[model samples]
Target: MSTTFWIILAGAIATYLTRVGGHLVISRFENIHPRVEAGLNAVPAAVLTTLVAPAVLGAGPAEWAALVVTALVSLRGGLMSMFLAGAAVLIIARQFVG
Candidate 1:
């Protein structure tokens, strides 16, 4: 095999081993502390906000408008309303502007 192929294969093997090792090591820790578990659970919301905040704030007027519309719709209803609001806002913005 070529040098490139060998390098890629080695990288894949290393990645797989690291993931397997992590699972094995973590599983051996019989009891997770409650505070640590709570912290881990909060991570998802933190990550979601971190990713969404920048785009909603930094992007131009169109994105800001869409974010506001989505928030209002979501508050009124729920996830379904949020999805519809985003799609409608995006379609309208694209049609009118672009």
Candidate 2:
């Protein structure tokens, strides 16, 4: 309808096609190469570090506390639980730190 709308629609379609194309290509391979598999396995951590590293540089005590809680919770809890715990700690810590 609008230029912004068309741009967003184009982006969405491109993202979906890229994802499906990757899956289709991977599925065609009977056995993945060890180096390729290792690179793929590292994707999650690399993505996570990219997301967190910039924030870490400017984070304050509340953020640090939340990060510590999140890390500790992640060791024993599922993703949802760890997220909730970290969110709760961040909220609580902000009250005092602020």
Best by TM-score: 2
In model 1, the worst 10-residue window by lDDT is: 56-65
Query: Candidate 2, after superposition: displacement of residue 16 in Å?
Result: 0.6
| Steric clashes per prediction | 0, 0
Model 1 sits at a Cα RMSD from the real structure of 4.7
lDDT, candidate 2, 41-94, per-residue tens = 998899989999999889999999999999999999999999999999999999
- Top candidate, metric lDDT: 2
- Candidate 2 local lDDT, residue 95: 97
Report, for every candidate in turn, its global Cα lDDT versus the true structure. Answer: 0.82, 0.95
Colliding residue pairs in candidate 1: none
The regions of model 2 sitting more than 4 angstroms off are 1-3, 27-31
